[model samples]
Target: MNKSLKHLSRNLLHGVLETLWIWRDERVAARLGWYLAVATNRMPAKYLICRRTPVDVELDAGEDELWSAHREAAKVFEETFGAVRSGELRLRELQRPAKSLMDLKVELVKRMLRHCNFCRWNCRVDRGEGAKRGTCMLDKVSRVSTYFHHLGEELPIRGLRGSGTIFFTSCNMRCGFCQNGDISKDKDNGMVVDPALLAMMMWELRVEGCHNINLVGGEPTIHLHTIVEAISLLGSVQPSRDKLVYLWMMKPDALSWRRLEPAQYLYEGELNAPILWNSNMFMSLETLEILRELVDIWLPDFKFGSNACSIKLARTPWYWETVSRNHKIIYDWGEDIVIRHLVMPNHVECCTKRVLSWISDNMPDVPVNVMDQYHPDCFADPLSPDYDPKYSEIARRPTREEILEAYRFARRLGLVFESISLEKSVFGLRP
Candidate 1:
């Protein structure tokens, strides 16, 4: 079911059931159904909005106009579940023989930049088109600690505008809870450029209209040749348009799967959007067999259903059998994968019912977003001997009935691709 997600599976299931009639009401689906039932559960503790201030002075202005009218009624429920106003979807079918989510997202970003091994310091960093730095110190240029246009994310990545992120700074896995730990533990001299000015910043985020181009954070597969020279200079200056671009990677290993071979040499025959990796699924199985041929959205990040908080948050040590064998190779490569699971305030029912109920008994129709946006930022180390959050108390915040009991365990794990919010579960702490 790849060929452009089988032509938008009945328009994204009627745009997520017409986003409950463009959010007619029901307190934005019971405040995003208590953060989508513990973010689909594997339990890392969930819920947060235990409030101490902010959240626009505690939900006013008519709950921020029902959270921007449930995000424009969930983009008219993905334009009636599956959206496609002409960004074409026949992403590969000429004589049909399968394999063509734009040639498996440019042969999975040029086979993760020809065997990149993205992060974990395996730095096989060649990044094609002449090499540079690696060991997560990053060099082949992709620097730029920030970019913008991020209307909060999710909802099929901020549709009616915003989602063109960027970030990229430098990290392989230093997490102590790194809420952008000052440019992922900055050593300075980053923001470097020139790869045709990073493909004119992805054609200036598609001429600032932005809807997708999010290649985020200090670990973009340790700079796969500046992300294949800014997606090969925005697919040769919009060779035929239809090239949205949205990558988010966070290390899945094996020379960052050879940077998905420059998205099929820059949007091979056009219509190329969705290649997000946003990892932490931990790797090998030959980097999930090179992300089943150049991903198209596998956001990954199951944090922990408890290997005692995935060996204490990302220090690794096989965190829950490598995020359940790379979430069953991203649910046997399908269901436009999303699963994000971060609710962290007191471990949402053991990280959402034992790791989102073992990813809803093996990818029950993939979609689980369930993030409670943790905070306690910039984790100060203070001579780390191991774990600290300044002498616990579970570092404060996270209770709204423990994020609605991790959103009623994502509807008892039947999980129909749930998403949640309750004002992004606050968490800016620091008093």
Candidate 2:
């Protein structure tokens, strides 16, 4: 095994010991890593694989030098061998570990500060405890514009009640078709808050009987560290099986940086909640690492197959390869990822037909959600000459046939979906 893997194994072992000690089950501690892998839909052996040598890892240690932490953890692991051999320990039986989780969260915050350039921009901003301000326009505390029960989402997300939505302000991408253009454009509406406040917000949402906390935003990647910290805090408070926290990424970047901190945090924090990524799959290898270990269900939109369309609509320079490669990565990760595409008025063929063909080739098993939600928002009026009917002289929505063709194409591609409908209407959720 590589030296980094050995170090990671040691760290994981220590984490497992801490987990068992707090949960009061030694057998579960011995097999914690395996259980985590299974729960996250990752192969158990993959835990032993080393992706990259961690930049923050200390390399000056002598061969004889062993970490005092790991040595102590090993003692506990050794003591639990009888329980493991007898097969009495169960993952379902493990109790919540509150203190160990906080310690691990503090460590995660430190690590994020050390190497937290996990966004698509990779601006190399340090956002640990002491420092402030990164490329994501955020500091130590994350500002949330508004958080409440919102019914304006897909079926599974909203369920019977609604998805508890937390809107974070400011964005990495300045997209023209942004529906929440007011919040994204405004610089003052955001309120910087600590993890405890966020945890309180989550608890408030849970008390309101929300199905899940939908982390939507200006750009979730910007305030991801704070978001993850809040997740840790909330998980530590209530270890409920029903409460799921969905991290919605409307931007079609390859992966979300939110997972980088929580991969280990999920187990160490004793969190049973699922981590959902709502992304526009702009493929990146680093994102795959996060998706492989962190995400449960991947909800991504394949915006456009044609680079010209994507460049014009989303202002993305490399749109085609990003969607194609990202779709493949999500596919390789598992069959639980969902792909969606909006049928733009005149760009149906470019967005749906071409993207659907690519999805069929790369990931046919992944569900495709065909949407018909297209209205020229304020951003598209005078600013976007191409999308503006006054400038282009095409004053009409997409024909019904274009929307129907997308659904038909998805079925032809053999893509399964929870629901493939997005009715064309104004997008809003009353506060």
Candidate 3:
């Protein structure tokens, strides 16, 4: 086959395999079923659902009492979700809570800004005052490097349309081989956007038929307040009549669109895109507590196996403990998640093997994407002026043998890796 034909055939095969895997794997289906429902408008997004689940605590409640209320609210959310999933109740039937969990989260996250522990770095700088900046190099405002329908994600995430990706500026970790170094390292690279504008970006992507609102950046954990607030605003903004007409016109297949009056559509203001939290998995437990109620899916990266490697390569301390702890917490919560472990050059034994082993032992049922797309960039690029001999070990792409070995190891551990693993031909390896 010609190169173009070969590429098309490969994509077709991958799509078929992705569908088959989702159908065959009950665990994967159970984990991602809610996300798929929200994407197709069969159910409301978690954030929208959160708006209807009340928290009894007052804004002035003590921190410990507030956390206790938060936990109770999470149980309520679970019960609500169960009803919705089982068709026992419709989303429209859900009464708005007096004080919603989302509202409480918004307030709590804002309070956290006073002594920012959003990420594990614990910079403790008062970001709300703008007097000091955290290790992420971001202050009160969150910057958007770009927002668009990104087609280059995993199968279920992108779907037929694409994943609505919003790239936030600045990251907590300083990975030497960072792919998005320009946006990640430069705090001034993108336009600063408040929660309102950020919400609109999400609205636009939903209108354009994107699957999930993919919140990524150098790292999104640092901008918890902005993200939670944006989600809240997205649920309340009633689009104009013209926009509703446009939305209906764009989605001709929407059967219920005709049944609802234009006025009804205006007042029912809710965005139905699943909140996909794409992050480095270095967030604090407090941040994770808030996100548990909002985020529909977690796209966390398991970057390093050892703290030594993480500290040396990504300038992140306590990599193993932090990432592993976070992963286990999310898993124990029964959250929908897909873990990505990038196969780096010459670090397969120290990183890839260890990460896969941990996942197999702990989260074997969770879908994992053993990525082979790592390439030298940023400071690791020899051609870049920033390159140093000290980072020479990861200055090249992973060998085909290394990629194959990683896949083989994942397979040995019985990990659900086929859903997002690269094709054999991509690595020039035998199947």
Candidate 4:
């Protein structure tokens, strides 16, 4: 028993070390060396906390109070990005004329890299020096695990063709049962590319008839600089837009020839196609603020509604309180929002129900995809020493009964998602 325990412990520690400064390919090693040699430090004059800590969020607000808050949030959203786009929200094209918005965001991202707090980890590793903290395992050079037109993402996102997905390598949050373990668990899983090459990749996807460019990961927000800059670069080389058809543009007609008030972003050339931010939703407020105006859709995963479940399964602290609160904010801020939750074997009562209640209670309009495609993976293997018997309750696939109950519960809560796959046997269509 002791010998087996020691072997498992050693392998886990080796895994941790490999996340930092380890490379499978020598080409990435050479590029990393080049980045470290030329990259300049942009450390802040004073470092302050960038992550939102646990606070006393009143989860049990009355219907009246919740409705009032939601209304106010909607009003604020309309005023900020309404028929006349305000200067504060559209600063890129407003005040900063003749300057590249992408360049500015890229610069800010590089500076942010010096103190690396893009996610909840807040490891404060100076990635600009081309070395990331253990959790993310990505340096200044962003590695892309894969890029393709994915039709499997929920109907709205995938659309007729598919959502153009660029999956980044390495992750900040390590879920023990992550389906994409080969891509997310290791940094050496993909080819390293700079922002320029990433831009070219997006252009290729656009030419290939992709619907929207979906930024996914291993937590894609970790490579905010690369993603933002790549989008900016792609927009620049392609045709510039006359007006931005945004949140309210869900309806279209033959009124194009009649010019009323133009969409706010006529002055700037941003992403012509809709950009979807497909993330874990464990993001920084500052990062969200920077991307609020840019991202057209928010496709976030509502992992666990119980902090205890999150701590055990995803190894995160205050995951329920932190991400749920963030989800409320994101729902009101974005043009369109989609929440994806995977129903674990035993988590229906503790996690699934709570998540559904919150969404129905506060964000009724936001679409949700209650996923049922979960099964035992690398960490959950019954024979693996790393598998804790305590979690055996959720070590197997969720049953057909549980799936049916989940759909019934979601429908009972008055939640509606046109794209939420009701299919019990399908994989990848969950979100």
Candidate 5:
């Protein structure tokens, strides 16, 4: 592993890969590249990470960590989210008037803004006056990058009509390999719409015949006040399932559903659609509590189990403790949670193993979406002068060996998959 020897080996391997390129099959070329990298010992240093073999992976959980979501399902989760039930979860539960609900949400969100403990950073700065800020870079509120009917989500979410997606601007945990770099990194790349406008956007999406209203962002939890306010507004305007279905029946055909007649579905000015909180689980209890009633699906990224991986890629100083605690919180809530873990290049051992191990032990019933569509985008690809030596480990793509190892490890650990569509997507389609 000496530097001079490594350099010599890599040059010889590169020659072989160049010679093999004439065949012109991507998988074959990729496989050839991987074999060369392994033979040359050019794999990322982090990828070589080792852990003490577990006596029993099933037994490693903290006394409560092994507590499965299935066992806790009926007991832990309140019926608050169901249309028939009402509690502190819903405005109707408090017997508050619809207008009062919005007022109460605004009042509470303002208080939260006074000392923001929303994201994992928990930077308790006062943002009430729209003058101060935190790591998230927000002054007082949230904004939108865009809103549209997106077909590129999981099956249950996207379905036929596509998920109604609202992309919030900026992020808390800005990953180095973030695909949405244009919006996540730039604070000013998106529109500066307020909470009320966000609510209106949801209603508009419903009218457009989207399946669910999904909220995604660089990280949405950072905009606590505005998000909660918008959720409050969304709740007030939500029509019953029966109403939503009746309106849909009037549509002539599926093709006509996309360009919908809003007037037909605007009963009482209320709308109905499941709400999806597409988030990185680096959020605090305070924020989760605020949206528990309104958010129907928990679409979260349990990205890294190793602090080294997170710190190196996302610069999040406390990703492991923060995300793990948050995962436990989600499990305890007993809600519908679909955890997403994008298999990063050369990250199988250092990141994937621990993440899968933790999930297998903790939320056994929770479905994991093992995504293999991780490309070396953004800073991770080393496209230019900004590329740091530290990131050189992950600059190349992950090999077939590592990808298979991730799947094998998950299977061996008895981890339940949310979907097996990642591989299909890996080759460019989920069908």
Candidate 6:
């Protein structure tokens, strides 16, 4: 078939199967259904709920005290989430508290900036001072490579409208075969965006009908403060009598020419977009604590199976321990999650098989995408001036046989991955 015809056929079949999945699978429906509800304003985003749940901790509370407060507030947030999920509480009925969990998160993340431990590397460079950079090569300020409705994500993540993708600059990991090297490696590649402007970017994507606000990166974990602050700003933008004056005084040069109207900028209603944490699964436990209340869905990458392979391929230390711990935390938390495992060239035994086996043994029910789109790029690109002979093993695409074997392994494990895997061709046509 022609490309266009083939595309149409695939989409039609996909839509049909997606509808059935939503109807049949409770887990699938809860995640995608809640996202759809938030996108359509039927329900409030998780951040909005966080904004409504009250917290009594002081901004400068001691580390132990603050964490205690966070724990208590988390219980309340969970209870509230349960009520909201069960239809016992309506988003309209949720009123913003004087000092909320969202506010506390903003404070905690800012404090973390002083010591900079967003990722497991724990660079402790005092990003707030902007004097030193971390392993991610990012200071306090975040740079945005781009923001748009990205249609190229996994089926459920993209949905019909598309996943609202905001690509941040710089990553914690130095993957030799990095596909988005331009964004991930270059700290100065994109414009530095403040919290307000970042929030505006999110608002624009939602206004254009995106399903979820996908916070991706080089890695989003490095920009935890900026991202959480942006979400807080987006959720708390209520129309007020001093709105015009606020808009006039707060207009930055970046937003001047395309001055948003009061309705758009002020955002009269709750800013509703499910926060999708598209991450590398290398975030600190502290970062994950804050995220548990904010993120509506988790899209994490399980890149390496062993620390040795990770050290060699991604140049990350203690990778197996850190990534697996984070994944188990989120999975056990009962969060909506979809895991992505990229199939690389020549490491199926060391990486692919181990990753699949671990998922089967631990998180068999989580939707996984065993991706086959690896290509030679960045340091892995032999043509690049910076190419190294040591990384030549992954310099080509995975063979068709390798991809098939990976799928076969996943199938043998009885993994719940068909929705995101190539098995969609047959699974989508199922009765």
The lDDT per prediction is 0.48, 0.49, 0.81, 0.60, 0.61, 0.79
Candidate 5, after superposition: displacement of residue 309 in Å? Answer: 1.8
Model 5 misplaced regions, further than 4 Å: 1-103, 235-269, 418-431
Among all windows of ten consecutive residues in candidate 4, which has the lowest summed lDDT?
43-52
Candidate 2 local Cα displacement, residue 177, angstroms: 1.0
lDDT of 2 by residue, 1-431 (tens): 99878766663333222221211322222223333333332321111111110122222333123233223333333333224324464333433333232233234444544455545555556655436454445555566777765666654444433555677786655555666766665644666656766665655553444444566676555555566566556644542333233211211211211222345334333333334455555434443443343344456767777877766765666668766877776566343554667777777676678888887787765545577666655457545544544323213456888777776777776665323353223452111
Candidate 1 Cα errors over 4 Å, as ranges: 1-167, 170-176, 179-182, 185-189, 193-196, 200-214, 218-233, 237-274, 277-335, 342-351, 354-364, 367-382, 385-431
User: What does the lDDT read for residue 300 in candidate 3?
Assistant: 96
Candidate 1 has what TM-score?
A: 0.29
TM-scores vs. true structure, each candidate: 0.29, 0.62, 0.87, 0.69, 0.70, 0.86
lDDT of 5 by residue, 1-431 (tens): 99867765653323222322222433223222322232122321100110101112133334232223212322222332232222133222323222232343345556667778887788888877657688888888566777776778865556445677888889998688788987888877776767766766676666665656788888777776887667656635543565445323322332344444444233222344556789988888767665654465678888887888889888988889888888888678655677788877778887888888898888876667788777776777788555566777778777878877887888787665624335245555332
Rank ordering of all candidates by TM-score, starting from the highest: 3, 6, 5, 4, 2, 1
Write down the RMSD of candidate 6 (Cα, Å).
6.0
Ranking by lDDT: 3, 6, 5, 4, 2, 1
Question: Which 10 consecutive residues of model 1 have the lowest summed lDDT?
Answer: 44-53
lDDT of 6 by residue, 20-84 (tens): 24336554565456655554456678887898899878868887777788889999999999899
**Which residues of candidate 6, in runs, are more than 4 Å off?**
1-27, 30-33, 235-268, 423-431
lDDT of 1 by residue, 87-123 (tens): 3332222232232122222333444554466544445
Best by lDDT: 3
Indicate whether candidate 3 or candidate 4 has the larger lDDT.
Answer: 3
After superposition, the stretches of candidate 4 with alpha carbons farther than 4 Å from their true spots are 1-81, 84-96, 131-134, 237-271, 383-390, 423-431
